[model samples]
Target: MTVVAADAAVSQVDAAAAAASTRPRCSTEDMLQLLQDYDCWVFDLDGTIWRGNEVIEGVLEALELLRKLGKKVLFMTNNSMKSRGSYLDKCLQVGLPAHVDDIYCSSYSAAAYLDSIGFDRSKKAYVVGERGIMQELAAVGIESFGGPDDNEKRASFSSEMLHDTQVGAVVCGVDPNLSYYKVQYASMCLLLNPGCLFIATNTDARGHFTPNLEWAGAGATVGAIKGVVERDPIVTGKPSPFLMQDIAAKHNVQPAKSIMVGDRLDTDILWGLNTGMATLLVMTGVTDEQLLVAQRGSSNGVKPHFVMDSFGDLRRVAQQALQQQK
Candidate 1:
């Protein structure tokens, strides 16, 4: 080849190498390096770790390996139906290694948000959720009423109920026992009280309760209240920076040195991106390979830095790395 042609080819090769180095690693071949690169690993719970009541295969093993490697692990979930203590219990029940401090659920986030805002201690909150929300609120010394109790109190909407101005905030989450009365009370609390806060644990559209069905999630309840009140709620779950910022500050986690692994692009991946952390998309729950591929091809899509078929793959990668070292 001519000297000029050889020089041009070498330049092209160097340029390609530089471009490749700048791109995020997606291939499984780089999993070992990724495992070593991050100091902290943040995981999305529901889809990435477990679906319904069953734990995903190899998840426990992977978590054990991460702990062995001295990596800081934290579980973050948008499921506001349960408190952090309940989530810790679920993790222990499923044989997953976890600590209550390492778990951050939307239920806790909502309470923390209220605490951060200097909510009046004397005023009570009208809860349109499960016991989890109530538990977290109480833990922070915030009194709440109207969760399951309101479900059975399906009395006619009385204007007198709105006259009670003790309710300073209206907190909503996924409630299987949601009733019109609960909605009516929560809506009235927000409408009548001038400074009554409207807070939603999350706005997730669907939840996985059973293996075959998708149940209406907190968004359904949040939407119901939003539709009636004509006001946007302050969301405290995934894709919201409040929880992420709190975690970073409290845990001293550096975004650059942490990786967020989750199953959903919109919530999990988007949350990671919003918080300046590396993101890994796992196809174990709500997201599938087809959906991931389509998202990657979309012009304005949010893509993860890495993609794994399942979180279990991390266990396999760790095993392989260990074997290679031996």
Candidate 2:
């Protein structure tokens, strides 16, 4: 084939994808019927709720509809860079009525996991993330070292530097200020301490903001430590089931009666599958129809139970149900 022919073929594929995205997998009646089975709604924040600083269209209205229907709603995110309180603030800023109890983030889950294992003030954690990790750890009375402020401003470091043996755990997330010193110190703590714990918030290598844009995720920093220490860290975010464990114990979530709505198939859909809940994929944030089309016949990876053009359509479905009731 000629180069022009290849270009035309590529353009055709793009056009086909554009058309597929505007289509919905389930009818309004079917969606309402399916929603009746689930009492609790668990959502992913980034791609599912909002992208960057902009709230997705119809998300607030959809949430309102769910609330009016008496569904228990909770927000779950794998981005460990912010605390739950911070996330709650973002929700309110975006016109989503949210309570402090309604938000759950990977930082909170990581801290909760630490607290579950008898973590206390007596133990110390060396963290590679930002203030979010520190804030959560402090809430549980766990002391942490090597936060954003602890990072060295200068490149001066040597093996002669004193090592702190009190660090019983090394926790890592997305750290923009990640440096060789942070990696070296975390490696020292894990290497010197015979039973030191290594934990990660999420292993997502990259996050997709739009179909054509992407950004780094927590896995990048976590992988840096793994490269130096040659050991795998315990992941505490989606697909790990740690957050679901807490949600089940506290929120009384029944996996069969719950719905996990997200944009990323690997993290959100896979997480719901791992927890035995139905999953919904939305195209507002990441993972377009082209990718979903490829996974349609596969039995291996987690596939969403339903797919939609965007999260706002769920609100429209709910509105239709209300009209039917009227």
Candidate 3:
């Protein structure tokens, strides 16, 4: 789908900052300078700009500033729990701005992966995740396995089904009702046939879903299955170079000029760094200051070229780079 940045993104910062101030530091002028060069930006939302119910301070201002500089902004998140429409509402609720074409979530990536790989959903495959994940499956023509046409049962997911020829693959993610029985069924299928593929939505460790933080993300569960099945599953999420390719294609932007921004080392930052794209690690979520600081010793320069306390300062780097050219 086409993703665009929101107009509210700029104005939404101050109020959010007042509500959340226990954050890092930034320089306004520096951010303004950085904005001069880069026209496109890919942002990670959760920790970099907001945490749960509260939006990060100055995030809206940062976004607005980017708009002022004529930069193209997009939100790229690895969490595939919520659908694009839900995310549209999410931006409105939090005061962030981006067009529907500017939002690229892991679900989009997963859907694109299925599309590129030519996954035929005519067969049966048990689902254990959120609606966003299922939506991606449907985009690829992957329907539920329990339909009358397939003669599959809703609870057909089982060790027996895994061993049976009818079962094709196992797709897992964050489902509150996930149970040992469900896992047993998924594992049974993978274990039954080493050729079956396993796919996961993301690898986020933890998210402030609500009143309290929750267990890390879809990674551990997929990892556990990999350990048991002794077969590697194909990861259909961020940092795979595939997502960037899809985004670039849709936006018609040059990957060489675009930059990816976020607060996590594993998902947001590394996704860009590993794929030969410029990345910025905003100290708003998952990886803290200490960890980001300690992580700087990489001799391979595999680390991000720049790090900022928040998205608010992104413009500074760009502005400064532009000045040097003058």
Candidate 4:
């Protein structure tokens, strides 16, 4: 994850506009052809696969159908609330067979970025998130400090309080128990400490993982610290493009032979477009039909190559594809 300018992101949006102009929405024949074309399918978890505690009705069958057709399946998520293991657990709990290696989240991406950069484990990261951030870092042998612990709870901080000198980075994620103290301490690490890295799992404003409970997302915590520190973070989640590259490198996924399915237009669709992969927008989570129509011809945001009413629709297509393969 590296800090990128607003212009860099805006430029991606503009590029997407030009590329999308020549493409038409998928027809029934196009849908079946798409299923036949891709050998790998990457799906967003929160809305595409499951919503809250319940699994999206036909997605489980869809995944099975895809696997039966010898397709590789992977889960890509921007929700940094949990580690990859947790996500895998959730997938299995809801009846999807998920292997640990098949799950990817912003947390793991951040860890991989740090690992690639040879981050000094000797220096601790001042965390402004939940235990998941710490857990992922630990899995990568990176040390972190200050998240959801009793000592971090209700801690008093003033301008006079001494900053932790050993803190070399300010890592932010989804902190449900976010306090002013977390922001203050993280800001101090970034502003006062020399050579401090500012990292964010994702910059999503809110979470839609669970229905009816709109939780403040990791972006909120990152934004709070960014406001205090007057800096931009190296976002390691969706829309980063680096993440998609990493995915391809790790899983040997060919861009032309893989597809990304998600409910969010900005993050999910943008990631796919930016990384040269096919994008599918599902109407199960964030983006609705009205918004999709309004943005259809806009040059300011990313557009999907195909749009489906739900992943269940994709499931039906995959089912047909499987039958034809027999």
Candidate 5:
């Protein structure tokens, strides 16, 4: 699992590309060994587990096997469109054995981050996202407005619309109902209201909502706000080390004894690397082999320790391991 440093004479990009070419593929034996070695398994949801509404093939069985084997299994995602409860419902609907406690989405993380920062409970938050952000904020006793409610407001922008000077923070996420009004309101809050914090659940540029297409993600909305406000928002999701540090503290997760299974190198794999966990890249979500290979030269030396076609492939390894044990 160690990446040997390349020759100093080689260019940095060339050395990284060379190192990537030698990245390990998770063979059946390696998977089995991983099962034996790691006590905890952290999985990314969008790509590594399911795509859109469909569960990735055999992933349910693989998760069941992990639970049966007494491994700690957790699901993490940057998709801020849904709260952890909603995510748990989706998991149950798709026959994935998941508990509410095992789910960690950015919606929940955003709320947690606010609470950690001692955000004024009396102040209101303007949300340019969806019900998920609202739900999470409410759960933490923080008041919020301007989510789906503003979807109906199509009026031209004006200064009078920026009425809520009490808005202490503007939280942006993957807003399917994004509108000019929302962007203007969010921007005005940050610019007009003194010390009004700008927060982003995540900055993922694109998301794999369907098998054939990529859709604009939270980053698009964040970018729109940034354009108007000209200020960087605090990112609370993946690769930030905020949520990971919280997870480690609350869940007793020993990074060295855990493996992070994810699809995107920038977020999932990089987050694991930052937190000192082993990383496995799966190809069922946004990242494909071609993209993976292309990123080698541009990844700034970041590479996953192992690669696999799909997480469901682990079911086969688990089945084989169970048979051997029997």
Candidate 6:
């Protein structure tokens, strides 16, 4: 062919590719076929599944579909304000059926890890955060307690617990009602035990539901405590391997075959992308489509292979993958 003819042919190809790009996307089957290349499902809570007291539409259906398909599903969250039991209650409240074993929290991971390293928590503990952190410590078979005693079951707390105990380690999490005593106690413990591990559930500054005015999550609190004591905390939540390790160790999830689905680009998506796992960004929570796409353009490695508006959407995608395999 002549040179001019060759140039014309290339232009036509370019136009065809552009036209296909702007065309409507694939159906649910297409999406699943694309996603089923791998098989692990790691879901994030708060915004992706539920916001405040309301469950996101199609969430339960999505989870149910995943289970029926025999896909490995695990629930993971950075919120340290609640323990696994608290998460269990939240799941029930939101109409998502989940057992305690199915959910993983930062506090649970942090406490279990600390216990494995030979920190005896069952004797006496000086807690620095909320009910969730305390709940996790209790689950680790550690005897740590914080604040004051109001009755038999609950540890009615004040700033006094910081002054009362000999101290082992300092745990940090969201305590919206964070009293001055809590901070004082944490600082005191750090001052006493410089070798104490400072474990924080997450560093997210805001809550998904409320986004409170005084919001500075466990990360900020850890900073404050560290500043006073001149130390740094070991974070175990989003963008960290702590929660991922917890799930893989306890569950049958295979990272090579697993994918992380979350609403937040910084936490859930980043966790997977950075750690060599497949990532899917859902529009139901903290991050929507626009935000993630924009981040992908700016950051070198922030894009999820799959972008979804709802968990229900994944059901179709799963079926498609199964079909494609055959």
Which candidate leads the pack in TM-score?
A: 5
TM-score of each: 0.88, 0.89, 0.78, 0.89, 0.90, 0.78
Local accuracy of candidate 3 as per-residue lDDT tens digits, 1-326? 00112223323454544344343344555355445446788888777667666777777876776666567888877777776767878998888766777887776666667668776655556665667766666766766432122223234433334345556667766555555555656777777755566776675656645423545566656666666777766666665667777777788887667778886777777788766667777755665444544456444323565667566555455444445645
Comparing 3 and 4 by lDDT, which wins?
4
Q: Which stretches of candidate 1 lie over 4 Å from their true place?
A: 1-26, 157-163, 323-326
Could you give the candidate ranking by lDDT, starting with the highest? 5, 1, 2, 4, 6, 3
Candidate 6 lDDT over residue span 1-326, tens digit each = 01112123434554443343322223565466545555678888866777667676677876776766677778888887778998999898777888899888877866876776888644356555667777787777776666233112222454234254456777777655555556666777777764656777777765564421224566567767777878667777787876666677777667878888887787788889766788777655655333444565574647676666566566555555555556
lDDT of each: 0.82, 0.80, 0.63, 0.79, 0.83, 0.66
How do the residues 1-326 of candidate 5 rate in per-residue lDDT, one tens digit apiece? 11112122123444454466666458888999998888889999987788777777888899888887878999999999999999999988888877888888988888999999999999999999989999999999999999999998864634356459999999989988898888988888899899999999999988876644678899899999999988789988887778877778877889999999998888899889988999999867766554566666563756888887778889988887777767
Candidate 1, 230-279: lDDT as tens digits: 99999888888788777788789999999999977888899899899999
| Pairs of colliding residues, candidate 1 | none
Query: Among all windows of ten consecutive residues in candidate 4, which has the lowest summed lDDT?
Result: 1-10
* Residue-pair clash count for candidate 5: 0
In model 6, residue pairs whose N, Cα or C atoms come closer than 3 Å (at least 3 residues apart or on different chains), thus clashing, are 32-317, 33-321, 121-142, 121-143, 122-142, 122-143, 125-144, 148-156, 148-157, 159-181
Global lDDT of model 5: 0.83
lDDT, residue 102, candidate 1: 94
Q: Where does model 5 exceed 4 Å of error? A: 1-20, 155-160, 299-301
Candidate 3 weakest lDDT stretch, 10 residues: 1-10
Give per-residue CA lDDT, model 4, range 1-326, as digits (tens): 11212223334554554465445446679888887788889999887787778777788988899889888999999877689999888888888998898998988878877887899989988877777778999998988878887234554534356678889888888888888777778887898889999999888876674664556788789889888888899988887877766777778999889899998888889888878889998766776544565678676856798876667766777777877888
Clashing pairs in 2: none
Error of 5 at 61 (Å): 1.2
1-326, model 2: which lDDT tens digit per residue? 01112123434665665455443466777689866888999999887777777677788888888888879999999888899999988888888888887788888878989998886567799998888988998888889978797676434545365568989898888887888878878888999977889999888877653323567788888889999999999888887887887888888889999999987888889899988998888766656556766676465755788877667788888887667766
**Between candidates 1 and 6, the lDDT winner:** 1
Q: Report the candidate with higher lDDT, 1 versus 3.
A: 1
Q: Which has the better lDDT: candidate 2, or candidate 3? A: 2
